[model samples]
Every structure is written in C-alpha cells, then in structure tokens.
Target: MTRAVAVELRGVSCEYRTRTGRVLAVEKLSMQASDREFVALLGPSGCGKSTLLKMVAGLVPATAGEVLVYGRPVVRPLESLGMVFQSPVLLRWRTVINNVLFPAEATGRRDAAMRERAMALLRLVGLTGFEDKYPHELSGGMAQRVSLARALLLEPTLLLMDEPFGALDALTREEMGIELLRIWQEQPKTILFVTHSISESVLLADRVIVMTPRPGRVAAEITIDLPRPRSGRMRVLPRFGELVSVLQDEMGIAT
Candidate 1:
C-alpha cells in the first residue's frame, strides 16, 4: 500500500520585509514527507531550510502557496506537531522530568497518565536515571536527549527537527544520529530534519531533499536505499560514500 502524505508544501514562498526591502528566503518550494518517513532537508546557511520547517509548523506564514499537514491547511500553529531546534532549549530551572512534562502542563494534560508517559519517554531516550538532573548538570548530548524526550512526550504525529545535532562534537553527533534512528524506529513518527552536513543527512534520512542556495527551492531529491537499523559501521561502506558523494555534488562540490 502507498503511504499517506504526512507533510507537504505546494509552491511555498516566504518573504521578509526588512530595511533592505523585501528579502526572499524560500521561493515556490514544494516537497512532501510520507507517513512515518524520515526526510532530511539539506542546504547551506541562509538557504531557507529552517524557514520551510517553520512553515510546516505554521510558525512562519507562507508568502505564497500552501502548507499542509495531514491533509489540512496549516494556517495556525499545529497542535499535533513537535519541534526540536539546534539548541536543546530546555528551561534552566526545570529538572529533566519536569522539562519533559512541560508540554503536557502547558496543554492542561498534566495528570498521572501523562507523568507516567514522560518517564517512559525518558527511558526510551536512555535517560532513565537522569530524570531529576538540571539542564546545566547534563552534558550536551544528555540535554539534547531530554529535549528529544520532551518533544515526543505528547506523541505528536509529525516531528520537526532543525539541525538538532548540529552543536555536538563529531563523535557525539554520530552517536546522536544512531540514537535518533533508534527512537524513530520504536516510536514511528513522521520526521522532517534540517541539516547542513552531507554525511549526517545521508546517514539519517530516507530521502534527502537538497535545496538551492538563497531563495531556496529543490535542487535534487535522492532516496537512500540503505538498510534499516543503520549503524556507524555502515558509514564506511562503499554505497554510503556514494550517496554522500551524490549529495555533495548536488551542493556544487565536484567530488
């Protein structure tokens, strides 16, 4: 059976009014993520990759065209979606479990069942014993794990992650990618991830959507035919290198 479309952008454009006149961030860009798909948006800085993600979440208005989620037009902030930014953005004062419970508290669903679910999520992200730790006490990877758990707390159908692992050291970044895949497989939600790293995109995405420089649009879309349950060992495989090379070429690299 064909998978349902979870997120879509139809000829979407986003323009900002600035002192320097109108600045176009995204121009007539279109793309779709099917149900439970892991789609990565790959582009350089200022390419509007993050802008497109915001449009899907209804955080940013589209200048033209339509943004849709689960077949509904996105005119306001979507309730059934979660977002993870580059920074973990955890509240400094809240403990890890409280941070995970924050969304439920905001939505007035902070009950016994929700608290139980929050603990379960912390366990899912491998943070079983760190629930009471403050944000400053946790290392960068641990903190991002808390953020990931928090985002998944409500069990949103679609997850928008804007370069979520971009700030970590190289080794930690690779670990997070594998951990994310594990969580995704167990939880099974549609994910739209934004990243500037070619290898990271190739390792994490089912289909990599390459965006053009400024005023972003689709430059290419490449499907990663690698096997599921991906691990770091796969990175050394010839096929993995080939896919990374293709994405590099799409970004104007000659190798």
Candidate 2:
C-alpha cells in the first residue's frame, strides 16, 4: 500500500536579504516525505539543511515556493509539528518530567490528558526513573533523550530533527540512533532529520536527500533498501557499503 505524502516542498527557495546582497540558501528545492517515513537531509556544513528544516518548521519564511504539511500550506508553526534541535535546550531549573511537559503547558494543553501523555512519553524515552533529575544531573545522552521525549509529547504527525545526536560520542551516538529507531517503530511519525554524518543518514533514513553547498539544491537521493530495524551490524553488509560509497561520491568524496 502506498503511504500518503505527509509533507511537500514545491519550488521552495530561501533567499536572505542582507546589506551585502541577497544570499540564497536553498533554490527551487522540492521533495516529498511520505507518511511514517524517516527521511534524512545529508550534506556539508553550508548546504542549508538546517535552513530547510527551519523553513519546514515555519520558523523561517520561504522566499519563493510553498511548504505543505499534510496537504495544507504551512504558514507558521503548527501544533502537530514537533522539533528537536542540535542542543537539548532543556530548562535548567525544570526537572525531567517538568521539561517533558513544557510543550503541553506552553500550548495550553495542560490537562489531565496532557499530563498523562507527558509521563507516558518520559517512560517511552527511558526516563521513568529519572523524572525528578535535573538536566545537569543527567549524562549528555540522557539529556538528549529527555529532549526527544519532549518533542514527542505532542504526538506530532511530523518531527523535525537537526543533528540531535551530533554532540554525543561515537558509541553513544550509535546507541542513541538505535534508541531513536526503536521509538520510531513504536510511534511512527514522518521525520525529517538533518545530519552531516553519511553513515548516520544511511542508517536512519528510508530516503537520503543530499543537498549542495551554499545555494543548496537536491544533489542526489539514495534510498536505503536495507531491512527495517537496522542495527549496528547492518553497517558491515555489502549493500550498506555500496550505499555509503554512492553517497560519498555524490558528496565529492573519493570512495
């Protein structure tokens, strides 16, 4: 069965007007994110991946083009969209559970139902025992997990993640990736993840959308045909190497 398209960018371009001149971040970029699909935007630092993400989140306005979420034009931040940034950005004073409940409280969703939902999300992210822990008391990875739980508290149909695991050590990053996949499996959401790690993109995305530098555009899109529930072991598979090589070539890296 064909899944519905959850989000789409039609002729999307982002231009910034500065004293110097107009700086183009993205140009005529178009893509579709299917329902329940995990898509990764992979490219170099100046590729406007984060710009595109901000646009999708309605935090930034598009210069020219249209952004649609679930067939509706996305003019501003919608309640059904959740975002996780590179930093955990948790409130230092709030406990883990309180931080998780921030979204609901901010959106006037603070009811019995919302509180129940927040607690459930904390449990989902393995923070059940750490509900009262402060952000400084937790490890880096644990803090990020709290961020993840907070993002999911809204049960948004669309989730935007900007290199959420980039700050962790390699081993911790790998573990978090696995944990993310597990969470995704349980509560499937259309995810647009931005990352510089080619391997991380290949591991998590159903479709890897590569972008060019500066005035970013779609450079290439390599779909991962590897089986679902991907583990670290899958990285050693021949097909995995093939996909990695292909992405590297697209990124102008010699295989």
- Residue pairs with colliding backbones in model 1 are none
lDDT of 1 at 239: 99
Clashing pairs in model 2? none
lDDT of each: 0.95, 0.93
Give a tens-digit lDDT track for model 2, residues 1-255.
Answer: 899999899999999888999899999999999999999999999789999999999999999999998898888998798899898999999999899999888878888988888888887877788989899999999999999999999889999999999999999999999989999999999999999999999999999999999899999999999999899999999999999999999999976
lDDT of 1 by residue, 132-242 (tens): 899999999999999999999989999999999999999999999999999999989999999999999999999999999999999999999999989999999999999
lDDT of 2: 0.93
Off by over 4 Å in 2: 18-20
Top candidate by lDDT: 1
